[model samples]
Target: MPDAGTLQLSGAGTTKTLPCHAGYLSVSGKNNTITLTGHCTSVTVSGNDNRVAVDSTDALSASGAGNVVVYHWGSPKIVSAGTANVVRQG
Candidate 1:
């Protein structure tokens, strides 16, 4: 995901450092940790115990249990589903 494109990930107990300038990012499966750089149009996370960091995003959708999302810039519209998911601006 080095340029503007869609990135979709699915797995368990994995760690990834994503590239910059993404158009959209989607994650499924559990216990995956991810870090996203640059700007993105949208970020969607599903499943449990996933941790995500974004430099900036226009929109964020987080679903499932115990997921955490942190944004560095912009006031993005957030839509959350399921239990105990945390979306924060930092």
Candidate 2:
């Protein structure tokens, strides 16, 4: 189950920009590019070759292969698993 303020995106070869509103974001699938504006409480990404950029977040988790997550601000608690997953502050 997902939280009430959770935003989810799942697909392949897609691009989107959304507002976080200090809530949670979940992303899955392959070759997708996502940009999140506003403040995020938490962000989770799972899949292959996905790229996610966030303005700010308190927590960030990236899993699966070739996933990349970049946060512009905030000292987020970061977690990276699987092969070639990258989570970092930018």
Candidate 3:
């Protein structure tokens, strides 16, 4: 189970938007596009071919192959443990 102010998403080939609220955002699915609004404390992505864009974040962890994560602001800590994963500031 997720803690308070945590948002979890899982699915394939879908696009969605959600508010981060300075909390955690977790995504697990293939070929999904997720956009997070506001500041996020952390973000975790654990599925193949996923795309995530955040307005701001303190940390980002990606453990899935072919995943892309873009942060618009802040120098977030990044951990990438998957093949072909991309995490960058945009």
Candidate 4:
């Protein structure tokens, strides 16, 4: 995300607001190619497949953990209620 502070998400019949799952976010990587996984759940993005700005939409109850996203390009962005990881590299 270009501006982590500006990253927001929404759900079915829900308003567009910041992610919410629990209260933890985890981010990790080197020089940018990061890997985020933890307490968060349900994700949404704007772009993907290497796009500079990408968005991911999922359910917060299902992928609270063990959800891996492999993007060929773009920055590593993760925003949820539990945990998130955002970085720029590669």
Candidate 1 lDDT by residue in tens digits, 48-70: 99999999999999999999999
lDDT of 4 by residue, 1-90 (tens): 332332333222222223323222222211222233222333333221211211322221212233234323333343432223222233
Please give each candidate's TM-score.
0.94, 0.93, 0.93, 0.22
Worst 10 residues of 1 by lDDT: 14-23
> Residues 1-90, candidate 3, lDDT per residue (tens digit)?
223388789999989988777888899999999998888999999999999999999999999799999999899999999799999999
Per-candidate total of colliding backbone pairs = 0, 0, 0, 21
Q: What order do you get sorting by lDDT, best first? A: 1, 3, 2, 4
Clash pairs, model 1 backbone: none
CA lDDT, candidate 1, residue 53: 94
lDDT of 2 by residue, 3-75 (tens): 3298888999999988888889899999999998888999999999999999999999999999999999879
Q: What's model 2's lDDT at 47? A: 93
Which regions in candidate 2 have their CA more than 4 angstroms from the true location? Answer: 1-4
Candidate 4 residue-wise lDDT at 55? 33
Q: In terms of lDDT, which candidate is strongest?
A: 1
In model 4, which runs have C-alpha deviations exceeding 4 angstroms? Answer: 1-34, 50-90
Candidate 2 global TM-score: 0.93
lDDT score, candidate 3: 0.91
Per-residue lDDT, model 3, residue 30, is 99
What global local distance difference test value does model 1 have? 0.92
**16 Cα displacement, candidate 4 (Å):** 23
The ten-residue window of minimal lDDT in model 2 covers 1-10
Q: Report the backbone clash tally of model 1.
A: 0
**Lowest summed lDDT window (length 10), candidate 4:** 45-54
